[model samples]
Target: MNDKNHKVYLHKKKYTRDKMKDYTFLLPAGLFLTVFLVYPIFYNIILSFRDINIGNLIQGEQPFIGFENYQTVLSDPLFRTALTNSIIFTLATIIFSTSIGFAFALFFNKKFPGHKWMRSILLIAWMTPIIIIGTVFSWMLSGDNGIINELFISLGVMSEPIYWLTDTDTALLGTIIANVWISIPFSMVILLSGLQGLPTGIYEAAKIDGATRFQQFRHITLPLMKPTILVLLMLGVIFTFKVFDLIYIMTAGGPADATQVIPFLAYQLSFGMYRFGEGAALSNISFLIIGAIAVLYLYLIRKEEVM
Candidate 1:
């Protein structure tokens, strides 16, 4: 009995020591998250519920305003337009970018001359600064003296120059085109990596069995790539949802608010309009939407793992 008790005591002590060591490893990240991520999230939540303003900050007293800010935001037409645009932008980006990326990945997965160099060139768009891309695209898409219109006129594609940025119908599409150009490279790289990591033996076996390329891809490749596809889709959705810089630089959400997105709307409320509480509320709303998406993704991933 005494010997058994001593062994139990030793085991308990070892378990406690292991827990302490694990905590030590977690300390740095835990501290950083508390200071930066956690605090800001809570502070933003608090601000959303208050009557904070630029002047209030200088006065150092932000009175509680209950749900007034949220009510105002909900009643705003600009907010509705911004929300619609954000949804449309995100969905279009995910569909087009993922499809094009997958196609490119399939193409580049084959043995071809200059494939590596082609891939490197494609990645330049992804690696370049978003601001620079937005600025350059804005210049090229300009109405009268822009290179795009000039080339189109020279090629007899258009008799007169089209106003790409100023037109309400075309302005948003222009931003989408620029966004797609920058986004496809990222999707390609992810899908390409996934393609390379697929098991070669499966393809070889399929070939030995006299399987057609399309049939093999349908039965084998797609099933193997489902997980990667899910990840890429989620990433694309998240990236496009938060898009602000490109829209801001290109159109300033102008031409009658055609290209206004949630982030830009939030920025307008906070800085441009000096409505801090409303801006915070918009941010919180955006956070809730994104958080719900993240949670759904995590739940799906866990379910997949279990299956």
Candidate 2:
């Protein structure tokens, strides 16, 4: 070969080796996704179309039932209750938690004594395990000896102890209260970070122009914080949707299935009743819902960028 051709060949060989090395680094992640994420997803989708339950689950060959499982899940009354509870749980968690979190973010933004300590205290609920939070809240809302009932009665807010978790009307609300509390710290952290990143000079300029706090927030702060709020809302929705441990530990979808959200309902179908196909179908629906949230998040972000 000519000297220039040999040089070019060496360069190409080095480039190929570099590319190979880069791909080698990604091999582990590729395998992990294929095994743990991709395979399970495809298998679950296949399961959702089958007529397999626990007894026939391991046989690996089941009768194809097309959309029968989906139809059954949709037609089931229990599924309707679970869907309603899921919606209520998601909406209430988003509204209350984000509002409280925003309030906390605003409060902690100001310089004050124990500002760091007070802010850190808000994260305790989030750091605590879900089961622990569920158990503690369960105890705190018990009809017989709950601290809340006792305090309410002592303060004349109520004449007697209220069955917060055991009553059909109140069971979902009990779970919501706990979820809101659990969710707030995360939202606070997100909002606080967003607040901290805002240009202080903008707020000062707004103030100099005679803008009130509400006006500053409405115009300056909110427009800047849209992305952060989007993330907070999406994450809150997803985390709230996946809440099975908390609800299960506290109420186990009890009080006439009042607290039975989709995840817990899926668990009931799969583990409790051994209806793996139906459970898989329900879980697929849940996955699609979460995926929809992600799509919506992307759409909003792109729209905002265009604006």
Candidate 3:
């Protein structure tokens, strides 16, 4: 070959080798997703369209029933209740957690003695295992001789102990309280980062213009933290919606299904009652809802980048 042609050929070969090396580095991650994430997702979707119960899981033909499983799940009143409860639980937890977290973030943003240690100490609740938190909250909220009841009685706030976990009226509320407590630390850290990222110059300018602290926060802080707030809320919704361990440890979806959410309902159907098809369908429903939120989150991220 001519010298120039040989040189061009060698350059192309080097580029191809480099590209191949990059792809080779991605093999482990690709295999992991395909085997664990992608395969399970597709399997669940296919299973949702089948009549796969314990009776037919092993030998008998697991017939493809198309949308029958979805139909059954959609038609169930308990499914509706579970959906409603999921919404309530997710929304309430996000609202309370974000609010309290923002307050904590603001408080800690100011430099003070022992502030760093205090902030780190608060994260212990968040870093602790969810199961442990659930168990602790369960004990604290117990009706008979629980610390909460004892404290309330001593304070003359109540003459009798409230069955926080066993009574249907208060069961969901009890779970929400636990979840909010667990979520606060995450929210606080996220908002604290956002707060610290704000331009100090803008606040100084606002102060020079006779702006009050509340006014500066409303005009300068909120607008600057919009992206952070949006991302935090989206993540909170995604995580809180799929919560099962806390519910399982705290109430077990008891007190007449008062605390039943989608994840717990799916667990009950599949493992507890052996209704695998319905369970898969319920799971797919949850997946779709979360997927939509994930899509929205991506869109916002792309928009921010474009801006």
Which candidate achieves the best lDDT against the true structure?
Answer: 3
Whichever of 2 and 3 has more lDDT, that candidate is 3
- Name the lDDT value of residue 58 in candidate 1: 88
TM-score leaderboard ranking:
3, 2, 1
Ranking by lDDT: 3, 2, 1
Model 1 lDDT per residue over 1-307, tens place: 5999999999999999999999999999999999999999899889899998889888989999899999999899998999999998888888888889899999999889999999899999999999999999988999978899999999999999878988998888888889999999999999999999999998999999999999998999898898888888888888899999999999999899999999999999999988999999999999888888888888878888888
lDDT by residue for model 3 over 1-307, one digit each (tens)?
9999999999999999999999999999999999999999999998999998888998877999999999999999999989999999999999999999999999999999999999999999999999899999999999997899999999999999999999999999999999999999999999999999988998888889999999998998898898999999999999999999999999999889999999999999999999999999999999999999999999998998788
How well does model 1 score by local distance difference test? 0.91
- The segments of candidate 2 whose C-alpha lies over 4 angstroms from its true place after superposition are 58-61
Clashing pairs in 2: none
Writing each residue's lDDT as its tens digit, candidate 2 over 96-183 gives 9999999999999999999999988888998998889999999999999999999999999989889999999899999999999998
Off by over 4 Å in 3: 299-307
Give candidate 2's whole-model lDDT.
0.93
Of 1 and 3, the candidate ahead on lDDT is 3
Better of 1 and 2 by TM-score: 2
lDDT of each: 0.91, 0.93, 0.95
In model 1, which regions exceed 4 Å deviation? 1-22, 302-307
Model 2: ten consecutive residues of lowest lDDT: 52-61
Q: How many residue pairs clash (N, CA or C atoms closer than 3 angstroms) in each of the candidate models, in the order given?
A: 0, 0, 0
